[model samples]
Target: MEKQPSSRLGPLEKLRSFKMEKQKSFRLPGSTSFKEKKYKESPGKRGDMMLHLAARAGNLPHVQMLLAEAGEEGAKDLVSKQNLDGETALYIAAEKGHVEVVREILMVSDLQSASTKANSTFDAFHIAAKQGHLNVLKELLNLFPALAITTNSVNATALDTAATQGHVDIVNLLLETDASLARIARNNGKTTLHSAARMGHVEVVKALLNKDPSIGLRTDKKGQTALHMAVKGQNTGMVLELLRPDVSVINIGDNKGNRPLHVATRKANINMVRTLLSVEGIEVNAVNKAGETALAISEKSGSEEISAVLRVAGAVIEQQQPSPHPPNPAKHLKQTVSDIKHDVQSQLKHTRQTEMRVQKIKKRLEKLHIGGLNNAINSNTVVAVLIATVAFAAIFTVPGQFVEQPTPGYTLGQAFVAQNAAFIVFLLFDSLALFISLAVVVVQTSLIVVEQRAKKRMVFVMNKMMWLACLFISVSFISLTYVVVGKDDWWLAWCTMAIGAVIMLTTLGSMCYCIIMHRIEEKSLRNVRRSSTSQSRSTMSISMPSDSELLNSEYKKIYAL
Candidate 1:
């Protein structure tokens, strides 16, 4: 054996080292090992090895030689083979911008099978458009025109991708191939114009608009036209281009009712806001679905510059104004009915509260009256006992001395002045006081009434009895005073009588006056309550329309219609 160079590197290692050495000066930190990792990670890369390598290197001669050795059936199989990255040789060739290699592979192989997508979900056509390989894209489209309209996993066509990448030539080429491509939207309802406008692709937007100017009016899923998307970008030129086709697009509302001006104000883009406002016939005061105008949105966002621009443009928040047209009678009737319903509900609520308050006051007064009755019962019991004791003692200890022995017409234990007129008066009055006091005490102790009404009635009767007992007791004391002073000092008794009469009559008259006034006040309160009840009934009759009136109104509405 000839002397061979001693090397420990394997074939795969040799390939990585060769690639690394060739790219040493141009290599970034992690760029050299990418191919090595790709080879190591994918066993499928080992299949159809020469074709993938030739395609990756853009070696047209090597690819041709390999395809020539493998006949037609074998060449198709080799071209259809995928690496671990799911990329076919054609896909690699297209990605590397090898237009000849891509054309060679597509020539003998099935166009669909040759353009099979890799694990990245993009086939040769999409990769070519994304890589801006205009020749490769033209070749793919010429071979397979259906690939132009075909969507990816995201439902984005090649034209959409081209527009997104801001490739104005590719967009123009795709639109020329198929002008309808401008109308095709992605899954998000964004067309090529929307993509171009949002990405601030001024040339691409102009090309798309040149193809179909009406495409600018097409709204996305958000009801946002290209004008709306264009303002979101910083490019005011794109906005002017979009508005050039249709100025009314500035006033168009999205699903949220936000116009371009409103959107610009929200983003605080002063330049965008000014551009939108400068356009003639722009509806600066247009209110959105949320009832917020552009000025309102600007003020809320605290964008003073935007607010000033909008103010200069005569943007005002929309307010509710009375309609100049006559109101519809049916609608008016419905509103009147609603107002009446609300009023009736409120009035009923107030009436119920008033009744509840009246019941509360009545219960509280009854409680106070019961408390007073109980207090009176206790004090009356004590007063009756004291009066009874005084009356009984006065009868036995008369004003005159009692006769001790039987003599002439006098009897033992009899009062000496028993036959006197004043003595008789004292006896009669003392007996009356004693019996009345005893009766009052008996009634209080005997009655054990439990019901509130019956208890109150019993207390009223006992209170009147006690009042009589007090009056009789006072008369008895006054009569005994006359007897004690004797017949010659009868004028002194008269003076005493005068004083007692004045005091007793004054007290009794005051009590009678209080009772009469209380009765008058109670009657007055009753009359006022009756009058109020009648007034409320009359007011309800007037405020609440009757059925006949409602029917007449309905008939009038029908007649007017």
Candidate 2:
């Protein structure tokens, strides 16, 4: 006869050889030699016996053979034994969609305590529903109709689990068994309908809503209804379904007083927005806890698409406000004062910042202008010195040489003119050019004598003087040409003078263009600064009450002092 293996020297011996923090056992069915630790730590990971493993693997013959080896008493105890997760073999077979194995196990397992032990909350029916095993679920429900009310560890009934998984048939079966199953709140007071809407399960939502029409409006602990979840989930189909069932859901606010429309606009959900607006009974202009309507929220988010949709749907803008329901006159007055103070402070802060920015630009431009002035002064001084030199040399080197002896009625300066009027004009203009050029030099050298404020103006003055000196020099040359060429084609000299005038005009136009370009750049900078200031002001929005509100509440005291 073969000796029975001891628990210590059996297959458990392999498990005991390792240096583990906790001792574990792997006992076969009906074996009593092994010790008992807490069952929470089951053998190995799956903790499946030959019966449970056969049931899970869907080997019907293997399961039946294992059942035969364990007699009727041993088989019932074996089928009822739990695995690591406290699920029985019957529960495992049902969860895996092994309906044949489930039925066979149900014939022998403890139907009363299959998953209803004090330690287990998940039953075969709940597992079947969650796993979408319809045939197994029906069989379990047929045998034990009371399992419909069983909740999991989180107090979720079979209907809640089915709705959460979007198993429509399972949900219908559970709800048909017990209509009250639709109303159970699990996992933070969320009804099954809330779960379905949140998961975008349109069919599941419809089924649950048909079962209990009031379930559509039931809010969770956070005050979120099925409609709120639908909007938040951005499920247009589910949203439309929810709205048709209960149009009053349009006005029901979440914990933040935000209606479905408000949430849709916040999320910029255009499809949901369209669905909500199509319903005539919706409160398009409902205010949230922040006293802002859906329209206001869309505009604030800069979602013009949603805003336009809401506006065309006749969603009116809320009267901008401190909420009208101010609790008392004293708070009203205090709030008014506080709001005004905040607005003033915010505006003053932005104003100061804008002014500082403007000042910085002005200073930067002034520095550039001052730097250009220094260079202009130096350039003009060089031109003036050259002009003075040429003019002085031309005085002696007249158009014609002086007579060998002094010619009668003519000095050496007038010898070239021969007392001709053109000659005299030439001498006079040459003297004028020389004197003007000298004066410009003096002004450029003595620029420091001018006051700081007037120094900038002096640049304009000196620049004009230099141009004048050039004009005089040109005019002098034209006069000399007339004297030399003597009454033949005097208009030629005038043509030359006109050409000089055109040159000066072109120079002036170029200078004007530069100044205009500089001014345009400065104007553009100012515009950019103003744009930034406006953006800052918009971002720093004041939550102040409207003036109308302040007048109606603060100053319009109801009682006399």
Candidate 3:
């Protein structure tokens, strides 16, 4: 009597008819299972009430029963589906600390398949980690090993989330797996080490460093290391953790070459500064790229506590002044030529053996026409091409300032005067600075070449160079002022003088700062060398294996592992 199920209603009609027939013959939740409906409906449509229910009722039997009868296809639709906001059931389960539901949802292999993914589509591991659900995390990692590498939509892996949350145990577990701490970066170029140090998670920091001591010195985009972050975070425990022998705190700096000590000075933490100085070879007076030493930083930062620490550490606090210089052209030129010849000869001799070996290889390969040799030649050619390309791009992209701009101010008369003045000044100061820099470079090179021959104290040479830079920059500043004053505009003249004054001060300050820093560094290095010497002498009585044992014992132990 029923119009044969219309062909247009194909699959839908068939499903409905089947359900209706089954309802009469079977006691399914077809149309009359309010209780069952409440339980059987996927967690998405039910809101918080259902989430609570799922947490309470989503046991092995309950889920299995729902899966078996509800045609699971309907349930699969709810895997990642959201009820209100953009959160899926998996997210809800993970966030609510529902371990069983999280596991149940994760177990559905269908979720991993291409078609019906978890409604959240997020790796459940990240959610569990962020929520500090350690057990749930373990289960997820145990079941889905690939989840260790899987990142959420924001490109944060489970390990990253855990580190960010300061969940030490969770981070340790994630670290135990092959989830490389090095490979994980937040949206920033920051690593798990960065997060741990910033959060003052001392145990986590120690655990991370024990895994890879190199990470202790690894830098973020801002060029800050774990030590710098710890100082900035004002975590004394973390700072101590990072000051171990293995930490190598001096290895990194910010964009300005400001080290952890510099940051500590900025933070005005006397205790942190003391802790940092307690390291075996800390450089208290190390100058940054900006030429600001820790003491200078403290003074400039207006932090009295930091200044006191620096003073006690014997950091020099003085405004830099221009140094005196002598002008001698021919003698300096002769020395320079001699030094250049020596260096060139040394470089040539050192490269000679390698060059001869390469030539022999080339000759043999040419005679045989071997494929492997051809590949080597091709690789070398490719490398050469890349190098050439880079060189050309760099050359072409150089700033226009270097090439020259035709300033409207430079008339023929003015040009003539300026050129003559510049030439005269250059002859005086340029030659001197060049000679000094060249001399230092030669000495440093010669010392390296001759294997520390004569060992003329390096501090003396650095100090000499610093003085030369100051003198030369002072001369340059004076010349710049003269040139600027010669221009027509009175305001421009004053501006020029002001700029020269600033440049002169900055350059002189940097030079003196570098000199003082080199002296401090020399002293520190000497102290370390002396301590090592003394220790070696004290331990000299011990036999070979005993010395080895002592050295081995020096390594610090990490506890949070």
Candidate 4:
């Protein structure tokens, strides 16, 4: 009865009412509908579900159907929405390699506007190229060729992504589309050619250069050309490949002003150095920001191989002098003197020489720091013997829970005199050894204390000696266990004792060695500090003479040095 009134309405009246309702809906607040639109467009689980279904079904028809309704429709427009991670419909399509589906969507009139702001402006093309999907890339490029140079959020173009990932064919396709992409740089100023060269993708690199020859030696943000990354990676084969006849090796410098030679020198690779040096137009005298040449770094490292290589390349090894002037003269100097005196010059030269010496020692110290302690401990045969003795003592004398009573097996004559006497003698010797082992341990500890206090170079050696003592005690305990506890069940007792002895000895020896090495390091650091302090004090105490008293004050400064 209530619906009867509406059923009676004429068709013209119904059409007028429908028009009024549609107009009212359009009149609703922009903020309300816009917010709802944004939410629906957001890439969430729902968006992912639709995409999953579309991809699995390879349903270009459904995707096309959804795309046709985008912008005007609410939920269906979400197909173009960004996910939580900012992946868009196009990104998903390219990732899935759904070429037909991607083409259908791209063909839409609002294709460009449909792109989500959260996405890399380059979108699906970059993802496809990065993932090495050639067919998808061709489809996207066919639709929009300018996407070749379109950048990601990081300003990486599709060509850059392809080159970085070593996607050879994709790189080739992009390069062919826009030959200028070879020169177009990212925010970091790295060109696609730079990425391909660094990754050692020879075919891709050649193709890019063949497209545009000027990018052969372009540099990145740090001023590192493709050659620098190649050398640093120690990709010798790639390095060789990039060394085209026209490649300018010398002109390229990294952030540190280091050419390829500097990298080769630090790597201590003679062959790499030789290869770099052989390059045409390479500079022998080029210095890094530190004013250090390849030869200087090689000398500082004391690497004979690298030094020899540089020397062959006519590298000049410049000697650096220390600063004669005090770091904070007012704090140290009693009086001010004018002018650069002879004493000041001499002091400066001495400081410089000392600095050079310290640098050389530091290089050697690093090598020792890594493995010296372990190697020294293993080499000391006496330390090994001592550790074995201590381990034996622990295993034999440190009594365990007695599971059974000892059962003696011997003839009356042997048992009464020889065997029993031998047991007594063994006991006596074991006691003496235990006492001596304890004494050794005490002595070693005392030595460590002395070294820690004295801050001497010999402290390392002394610490090593202490470790040897601890090892001796540990081995003695292990040996005593095997010798004394095995009167019954000789085989089993001896086996356990042997294993225990080895473990105890090795552990104690290793610890001792580590402690000794650490002490040595401490002593070396202290010596360096002391030397620095003395040098500073000497520089400050002596004043440079004025035009009036040049000889008297200056002579004193010289004499002190």
Best lDDT among the predictions, by candidate number: 1
Candidate 3 segments whose C-alpha is farther than 4 A from its true place? 1-53, 56-62, 111-122, 245-247, 318-561
Clashes of each: 0, 0, 5, 34
**Which stretches of model 1 miss by more than 4 angstroms?**
1-48, 321-561
Looking at candidate 2, the ten consecutive residues that score lowest on lDDT are 552-561
**How accurate locally is residue 544 in candidate 2, as Cα lDDT from 0 to 100?**
31
State the C-alpha lDDT per candidate. 0.81, 0.77, 0.62, 0.63
Candidate 4 lDDT, 362-401, residue by residue in tens: 5555444434443433344345446446545543443332
Clashes of 2: 0
Instruction: For candidate 3, write residues 340-410 as lDDT tens digits.
Output: 99998887776676567656655554344333333433443343343334433432332221324455656
Error of 1 at 63 (Å): 1.4
Tell me the lDDT of model 3 at 211. 79
Q: Locate the minimum summed-lDDT window of 10 residues in model 4.
A: 552-561
Q: Give lDDT: candidate 4, residue 213.
A: 65
lDDT of 2 by residue, 1-561 (tens): 245656546767666675342433454555543332232223556676666677778999988887776788878777777766777778778879999998888888655755543245768888788899989988888887888888888888888888889999888888888999888898788989988999899999888888889888889888989888888876788988887776888889889998888888888989988988888788777788888898888888999888889888887778555656758989889999999999999998977776676566556555665666677778889999999999999877876676656766666444645577877777788888899899989978875834545765677687777777887888788888886665777788778778877987788677767666656655675686577778779998433333343334313322111
* Least accurate 10 contiguous residues by lDDT in model 3: 552-561
Supply the global lDDT for candidate 4: 0.63
TM-score of each: 0.50, 0.51, 0.47, 0.48
Q: 107-147 in candidate 1: lDDT tens per residue?
A: 98776785588887888888888989999988888888888
